[model samples]
Target chain A: MIDFKQEQDGAVLYVDDEQNNINSFRSTFRKEFKVYSAINAVEALKNLKSYPDIKVIISDQRMPDVTGVEFFEKIRHIYPNKVRVILTGYSDIKAVIDAINKGQVYRYIDKPWNNDLVRLAIQDAMDLFDTRKNLSDKNESLQSAYNELDKFVYSVSHDLRSPLMSILGIANLAEVDVQDPKSLEYFQTIKGMVDKLDGYIHQIIDHYKGSQGKQFGDRIDFNKVVDEIIESIKYHPSAQGVKFQVNLEQSDSFLSNKMNVKTILSNLISNAFKYQREEETNKFVEVTGTITSEKAEIIVKDNGVGIKEDKKEEVFNMFYRAKQDETGTGLGLFIVSEAIEKLAGSIDLRSTFGKGTEIKLILPGTSE
Target chain B: MSDKLSIVIVDDNEIDLMIGERLLSRVDQSIALTKFNHSTEMLNWLQREDENSFTTNTIFLVDIYMPIFNGYYVAEQITQVFDAFDKKAIIYLVSATIEISDNRKLMLNSRVEGYIGKPVTVSLFKELIKKHG
Candidate 1:
């Protein structure tokens, strides 16, 4: 209930064909609450439009034109939240009761209704409106908060990471000047540590983005997205010898958020590149997409150093790296999983220790 | 255009400014470099018409994040100043800013040729200068 309620202002609307009934209702309830009265169905709708703040609407059943139930049903969609109370005679009770769910009527009033009973019904309806309005207002604030967090994440990505890049740049210049073996090794170590820290920061950002709720929709072309991702990731340090093979059969349309799809693909593809075994000469990552109207199924198969049997389940855990000594941030698979979850998708991983790893994903789309 | 190009580097961080100077000097010893630790000061220096005219075929590397005004705003002021002075220069928004909006915004500015991320390698610098220089 709203803490500040002004009883003097009009909060209840009464509609009846007879002027005497309208006058009677006004005289009885005018002191305790404000009341608005309309003589016909046309005037009743006008009253609702004129006084949008009126919480409760009461209409007499024996109107000359439309019945009370018919009037309420016609205007229900326009003022679905407005407390609809039907005042009907004994014969009209069945019609009024039936319209309760259809018209979202709050209650029914008998023709010889008591003043106290009518007053209580109107008060209850007003309370319902207050509760609903408060909930919707809270939802609006949550949406605003979500937007604010998006901006904060953008700031944190730039503000917190730029200084680290500067340090890395300076360190690159220092390596050229410092020729001593010990100092050269120190510089290499510094770069390694800095690079690791940078990886952590990126994963943290991705985690936040992935864990967020579903995003806006844009129709996705799997072939185009896969090609774009491979081109972008080809510049990574570990992408030297790895060959990318892509096959997509997507005649039917699939709709999804572009960023979420990119995140999932990029993490899986990059990990394929990063975890490749040097001994394996023909290193390759194969990506296949089969999209139907309802969902898209993607498979990323890599002939790289695959995850061990015991550690397969643990790969999706944050900061849990399968290969500890390989300068890898354990958050890549975790990020991918989060992105998949956000899209309401599922993933299945199959791998052999020395041979390769294959990850399959089924992402749902809007069903036609 | 001259064989030895000029560079006007502006950054709030003193260390980044020095690193840029060192890296560029290593690329071409004879290249003229004018460094500024403040963006607004760089604007003031650009507007000083009484001094020797700042030459054309120069590259302006402006840091994106700064006090008072951002790099995009500074780029706007520089573009205006250049147009007024009838001076021609290319602006490359140099920063570690991970803002995705930069790509769209970069395309909007005619003066801004490209965006170069931090610790820009010798190969990347050489590639950029080779294409534009």
Candidate 2:
């Protein structure tokens, strides 16, 4: 599908110790391309240096000082983007074979080559050269853009956090300076606002960290991490009266970024408990999971204050809370959703206003 | 005197440098810290100090991006000057940068002892001191 319609002005250098071989190429390709002849690798290199627009170089396998394979290998380091090809006779079959494999010879033609085929091969090499150059140019631009964004983010975060630090410091000072009860309350509120700002900064940092994918991933015991989280929450005085039950499907060997998954699950489980129904005497949460061939399905069910069906979608949005009584940044569910998405997972919620809420997560498994 | 860890924090913002210094002092009173708002001054001070008597137990807390010279260049100088400081003068990059690659690139430098994200809390500071102290 190469468009040969364009005036192909590029030249091809033909190198051979024998004058007859070089003459054959010159006579064959002189009409279509500007064919340049070289006696050996020395002459070929000289021609290459002089004529930078030489897009392809066809050389004979048998040479006086160096074989075509060795010559191409040396040239590859110097002119890496140049397309190379080897022409060999029946006697130099092994040399040509080695040249093709080791030197990345674009194409090989036997001693007696068809004029049409040789022309076609040169055309193909020119097209390949064009494609590779275009791709390399695009790659360079993309890398520059990536670096610029990285620089901007680094400076922005650093600049933004410095002011936030000043705000928190002033708040800390005011907290001690204020004596009135209502003024103290206002300072406390200011402290809370500063803390929320700190949380947003932390979110930006975490978001940047998560963008790195994972640096280290190993087989982690999910049950151990889950148990530790559960134990930590259970020790909280809030869990004094609530009856807790755990039905864990043993050995949840998931191929995931453990820290991210832990964050996601801990938030979901804790939220389940936090929004418990006031009317229901029995405060309970159920966590369950099943692994399929392609994914791991996890369900966190709680008999707590449930979300109205209309607001189910809103919970995952940033700074979203269902009620005024809730004291949270509302970023937890949003962070959880981001974490789950990173694992190539989907989340769904089922809830009744006063009954309970159930969250289903389907995360990618180790499978082709 | 021997037990105290000498440290320097280089940042552009005065408030951040003060808070960082305060947090470090709160964590451990023994930590004698020198703060610099300009990275150039810090670099010059480091160069001058290296020619003089620079201790082996000193550590640097640097912000990655600064005017004129950045943390990367400062880290490069630290690596060369502190040839014998394999376990000393750890350059812990403290910034709020969200670019993971930037952090990763810094981590590639052996002189960069550790990385702590910005708005570095007292809790994290305590953990860092415990680990490196």
Query: lDDT tens digits, residues B33-78, model 1?
Result: 8999998898888777532356656788988888877789889888
Please tell me which predicted candidate would have the highest DockQ against the true structure: 1
Compose the digit string of candidate 2's lDDT tens values, residues A1-368.
Answer: 01132357677888889888777777767778877879989988999999888899898888879988788988898898999988887898876676677746878888778898888989998898899889999999999997987666665566676677567665555554567889888877886776666656666656555665563254445567678779857865446566776665644455667667777787888788778877688888888876544566778998888999888889999989787865567888888888887877899899988899999988776532
lDDT of 1 at B90: 87
Q: Which pairs of residues have clashing backbones in candidate 2?
A: A276-A305, A277-A305
For all the predictions, what are the DockQ values? 0.63, 0.25
The CAPRI-style docking tier of model 1 reads: medium
Compose the digit string of candidate 1's lDDT tens values, residues A113-232: 799898888888778778777888999999999899887887778888888988888888877668898988988889989888887777778777667636547678888888887787
Question: Please, what are the lDDT tens digits per residue for candidate 2 over residues B31-109?
Answer: 6788899888987877776433544467788877678888888788777878844447778887655434665777778
Which portions of model 2 show Cα errors greater than 4 Å?
A: A1-6, A89-103, A214-217, A224-254, A259-263, A266-297, A310-348, A364-368, B1-12, B16-133
Output the number of the lDDT-best candidate: 1
RMSD to native, candidate 1:
5.3
User: Interface root-mean-square deviation for each candidate?
Assistant: 1.3, 3.8
Error of 2 at A274 (Å): 5.7
